[model samples]
Target: MANIEQAATYYEVKKAEDVSRLISKYAGQGKTNKVIWLALIGVFIDAYDLTTLSFGIEQVITEFSLSPVMTGVVASAIICGTIAGNILGGWLTDKIGRYRVFMADMVLFVIAAIVAGLAPNVWVLIIARFIMGISVGIDLPVAMSYLTEFSRFNGRSNKAARLAAWCPMWYAASSVCFAVVLFLYFLLPEEYANWLWRVSLIFGAVPALLIIFIRGKYLTESPIWLANQGNLKEAVKILNESYNIPALTKIEYAQAVQIKPSHTGFAVLFNKTYLPRMIVSIVIHISVAFQYTTIAFFLPSILSRFFHTDTLTTISTTLGLNLLFAFTGGLLGVYIASRLTSRLVLIAGFAIQFLALLSLSLIGQPENSFLLYIAIIMLGLWLFAEGFGPGAQMMIYPTMAYPASIRGVGVGFNRAVSGVAQATALFLLPIWMAKYNTHVFLIISVFAIVPILVIGFLIKFEPTAVDVDAVVENDNIIKNLQHQISSQ
Candidate 1:
C-alpha cells in the first residue's frame, strides 16, 4: 500500500515538472499581444486615475472647504488604501489563483471610480478614493506575475523588456490624463470649472470596463503558477490555449518520496534564499516611489514655486516634461533592457537622479531666466533618469527574483513598502518645501543616494536573463532540500 501511494506521488510530481518545462520551452513562440495588453492596461489605468486629480486638487479643497490636515487626508486617501491592498492582494493572488484576483480587482476599480465621481462630500470622496486605491494595489502584483510568467527568460522581448514597458505605459497614461484635463479646462465655461475633476475621474471607469469585458478572451491563469499548485492537467491546457503549444501531461515512474507537500506563506520570503532579494527589492522600490511621489505628482506646484509661472505655463510645462522626458526615458529603458543588466541600469539611473537633485539644490529657486531654464532642465533630467532606471527595475526585480509560488507575495510586500514611502513623501513634501525651500532637494537626494550605494556597491545579484524562478522551483532542487532536512 505504501509503495503504491509513493508511486502515485512520484507520477504527479514528474507530470507537473513536464508541464513547467513545456510552458517555458514554448513561452516566446505564441500570440503574446493579448497577454501583454491585458497585464499592462491595468498600469495605464493606475497612472491615469492618480493623475486625473492632480490638476484639480486645489478645486476639490475649495469645494469641500477642507482644512490643511483634512486636505492632506483627502489627497493621500488612495495611497493609504494601496498599502493594505498590496499586502492582501499579494496574499490572495498566491493563496487562490491569479485569474480570480485579476478579474475581481477590475470590478473594484469600476465601482470605485463611479462612486468617487459621484461623491457629494469630502468624507464620501475620501472613502471612494480609498476603495479605488485598493483596486490599484491589488492589480500590480497579478500584473507583474502575468508579465513574468508569460514571457521567456532571454531575448529582445524577454520578461525584463516586457516589464520595462510598464514604465512608459505609466507615463503615457499620465500625459493622456493631463491632455484630457487641459481639453476640459478650455471646453468648460468659467462657471462650470468645478465639474472638470468629477468628469475626468469618471472617465477612468471606461478603461476598466473595457478591460473587464475583454479580459475573458485574453487573460488565463498563469501556466507556471498552475504547475506549481499541483494542477498539471489544467496547466497543460492553458499552455495549449494561450501559448499555442501542443503539449501533454504524462506521469512516469519517478522518485516520489522526494515530493514535499507543503505550503509557502509570507514568512518563506525571509528565509536565507530570499532575504537578500527582499532587501534589494524593497530598497529600490521605496526609493523610486518616494522621489516620484514628491516630484512627478506635484510637478505643477513645483514648477509654479520655482519659476513663478502662471497656471497655463505650469500645466503646459508639466505635460511637456511627462511626454518628452519621462515617456521617452521609459522607452529608452525598454530598448536597453535586453542589452544591459538591470543592476547596472538601476545604478546609472540613481546616479543621474542624485546629480540632478544636487544641481537643483545648488541652482536654488532660479532668479533669472537662464537660471530658471537650467532648473527646469534639471527637473526634466530627474524625471528622465527615473523613467530609465528604478521605475522599471522595481517591477523587474521582485517579479523575477522570487519564484512563481511566492512571486505575488514578494512583489506585494515590496509595493506595500513603496506605498508607505509614497504616502509619507506625499504628506511631507508640501510641508517640507514651504519651510525649507531648495534644501528639500537635498533631502530628496538622500533617496537617490540609498539605491546608488546599495545596488551599486553592496548587492551583486541581478535578475536580467536569469531564471530565478526556474531554479528555485525545480522539483529536483526541492526534493534535495527536503531530503537534507529530513536527514538532519
Candidate 2:
C-alpha cells in the first residue's frame, strides 16, 4: 500500500531532536483532550476494580464463612496481584510500545472483571481479583506514560495537572461503585442481598469493554515514545493525527542523521539524577497506600461497627463521604497542580491526616451522637486532604520524576511498593481493629507522620512544569552517564 514518495519520506527523518521539536510545537492542540480522556477512562476502571470489594467485603466474609486471616487474604488478593503486574507491565511498556501494552491491558480488564463476578468460590474470586489487579498494575504505568507523554511540559493543563486528573477519576470510580451498591441494595430482594458483591464487580467490565471499542478509533501511539524508540516516521504520523501538526516525513533534509537506542532497565532509575525522585515517590506512595487501604478500603466496615449502622446506612455514608469530600479534594488537586509544587500539597495533606488520625485515636469510641458526628468530620477531613495530596502526588512523582525512558519502570516500582504497603495494611487492619477499636487510628497515624517528616528532606526537585525528559535528549550524554553509573 506504500507509494514511492510516501515510503521515501519515512527515511527522511534523521534527527530525534527535530521530532521532539515538532511534537512540542503542537503539544496542546487538536485531539489532545480526547486522547487524554480515553487514557483517563483506563484510570476509572482501575479505581473501580480496586474498590469493588470495599463495599461487599463483609458480605464476602459472611457468605464464605471466612476467618479474620482468610478475610484479609481474600481482601488483599488484588493488591498482591498488582505487585507482580506493576513490575512486569512497566518493563513491557518500555520494551514494546505504549499503545500495544495499553490495548492489551484493557482486554485483561474485561476478562478479569467477568471472571471475578462469576467466581464460584473464595479461591476463584481471589484468583479473579488477582488477575484484575495485574490488569490494573499493567494499565497504570502505561496510562501514566500516556498522560505525561501526550500533554505539554508546562503551563495550564500541563503534565502535572493531567497526572492529577487520575485522582478525581479514581474517586469518581469509588463513588460510582458505592452508588451501584446502593442501587443494588434497594433493587435486590432481602433474600438475595448477599449477591451484591458479585454484581458490583461485573459492572467494572462494562467500562473496560467500552474503552476497548473506542480506543481502536481514537488511541494513537505516544509520539514522544515513538521518537524515543527511534521510530521517527510513525511518531510524526501520530503527531499529525493527535496534535494536528503537519507531517514532517516529506521534508527533504534533516539536521543530522544519527540514530539512538532507547535507554531502559531499572538500573538507570537509581542513577544520581533519578534516585532521589525514586526514593521520594516510593515513600509517599507506600505511606499513602498504608493509610488509604486501612481507612478507605475498610470505611464501610468501620462505619458499620463503630456506629452500629445497618448495611444500607453504611453504604450511603461511605458513598457520600467519597463524593463530597474525597472527590472534591481530587478536583482541587487538579486545580492547584498548575500553581503549587506537589511537595507542598503533600506536606499539607500528611499534616492534616496526622492531626485527624490523632484526634480519632484520642476520641476512642463515640459516646454520643455529637461525638459520632465529630468523628465523621475528622474522617472527611482526612479523605479530603488525601484526595489532593498523597493520592495525586503518588502518581505525579513517579510519572514526572523520570524521563520517558524509565518513566514506566519508575511508576511501576513505586506502585509495587504501594501494593506491598496496601497488602500489609489490609492484612493487619482487621486484627488491629479487633484489638484496638478506634485506637487503631493511632497506628495508621504513623504512616502519615513519617511522610510529613521525611518528604521535605527527600524531595528537592519540582517536576510541576519541568521538561525532565529533555534533560537526556542527547543520546551520547545518556550513554556516558549510564557508563559512569555502571562503572561505579
Candidate 3:
C-alpha cells in the first residue's frame, strides 16, 4: 500500500511536468496563436463598440435632441460599464478560473450589443451601453492573462510584448467600422441615413456572437492556472490532448513539482515586489485613459468642429488616420520592444503627443484652410506616436507586472482605473467641447503626459521579473534554507 501511494504521487507529478513541457513547446511553435487570435476578436469588438460612437455622436444628439450633459452620458455609457466589469470580472476570474470566464462571459457582451443597437431613447441607450461596457471589462483581463501565460519567453521575441498587439487590433477594429460606415454612407439613401448609427451598432453583435460560438468549441483554460490550482491531471490532459503533446516521466516530474498551487485573492498585488509596478500600471493607464479618451475618442467630432468638414469626410478621415498611424506605430513598438526597455519607449511616445497637443493648442483653431491640413498632420503624429509607446505597451503591462496568482485582479484593477479615467473623459468631453475653450483641454492634455513620463522613468520592467513559477520556486528554496539554518 505504501509503495502504491508513492507511485500514485509520482504519476501525478510526472503528468504535471508533461503539461509544463507542452505549454512551453506550444509557446515556441506558436500553437497558441489561435488563442491569441481569439483574444484579438474580443479586443476588436471592444474597440468597435467603444469608438463607434465617435462618428455617430452628432447624429445621435440630433436625432435624440440630447443636451451636452446627456450626450456625455451617451458617449460614456460603455466605458462606465467597463469600469464595473473590470472590477467584477477580474475578481471572478481569479476566484473561479480563466476557462469559465473566457467562454461564458461573452453572453453578457452579446446581450449588451443587441440592447445597445436597439435602444429606443437616450435613457435606454445609456443603460444598454453601460451593460455592454461590463462585458468589455470582464473580457480584457482574462484574455490578456491567457495570452501572457501561454506566450513563449525564449527571449528572441519577447512573448510578453506581443500583448501590445491589443492596440493595433483595437485600431484595426475601429478602422473596419469606419470603412463600413463610409460604405454604408454611400449605400444607404439620404432619407435613411439617420439610421446608419443603428445599423453600425447592430452590426457589432454579429462578430461578437461569432466569437462566442467559436470559443465554445475550442477555448481551454490556461495550463498555468490549472497547475496553480493543483489540478495537474486536467492540466496535463490539456497539454497532451488539446495542445497535442505527450506526457513525461521522472525527470519532467521534478520540473512539474516546481510550479506553486494558486490562491485566489487580491492580497498578492500589494506585495512589495509588485506594488511599484502596480503604481506605474495604474498611473500610466489613468493618464492614457484620461488624455487619450479626450483626444482620440471624439476625433470625428473634433475634426468636424475644427475644420468645418462634412460628416462623411470626418468619419472616413478619423478612422483612416487611426489605422495608418496606429499600425505604423505598432510595428515600431514590436520591432524595438526587445531592444529598448518599456520605459524609454513610453517616454518617446509621450513626448511626441505632448508636442503635438502643444502645437495644436498654440495654433488655436486652424484659421486658414491650409493650416487645417497641418492640423490633420499633427493629429497623425500624435496617433502614430501613441501606437509605439503608451497605447501598445499598456495592455501588456498589467498581466506581466503581477504574478499569475493575482494577474486577473491586477489587470482588472488597472482597467478599472482606465475605466474611471475614460468614463471621466467621456463624461466631461462633450461638455468641454461644447462650452470650454479648446486650448484649455489641449493644455490639460499636454500636462497629463508629464506624470506618465515620470512613472515610466521610475519603472524598469525586467522580462523575467515576475515569472509565477520562478517566483514561487525561489521562495520555497529560500524558506527551506532558512529552516535548515535555524534548526541547526
Best by lDDT: 2
Which pairs, if any, clash in model 2?
Answer: none
How would you encode candidate 2's per-residue C-alpha lDDT over 193-266 as one tens digit per residue? 98799999999999888878888777888877777776666777777777876666544332233345555688
Query: How close to the true structure is residue 297 of candidate 3, measured as C-alpha lDDT?
Result: 80
lDDT per residue (tens digit) for residues 138-177 in model 3: 9898888877776765464455566777777888888888
Cα lDDT of model 1 by residue, 211-264, tens digit: 889877778888777777777667767777778776555544222223334334
The per-candidate count of clashes, in order, stands at 0, 0, 2
In angstroms, how far off is 400's CA in candidate 3?
A: 0.3
Instruction: Judge candidate 3 at residue 290 and give its lDDT.
Output: 69
Query: Sorted on lDDT, highest at the top, how do the candidates line up?
Result: 2, 1, 3
Query: What Cα-based lDDT does every candidate model obtain?
Result: 0.82, 0.84, 0.74
Q: Pick the candidate with the highest TM-score.
A: 2
C-alpha lDDT (0 to 100) for residue 214 of candidate 1:
89
- How far in Å is the alpha carbon of 402 misplaced in model 2? 0.8
Candidate closer to the true structure by lDDT (higher is better), 1 or 3: 1
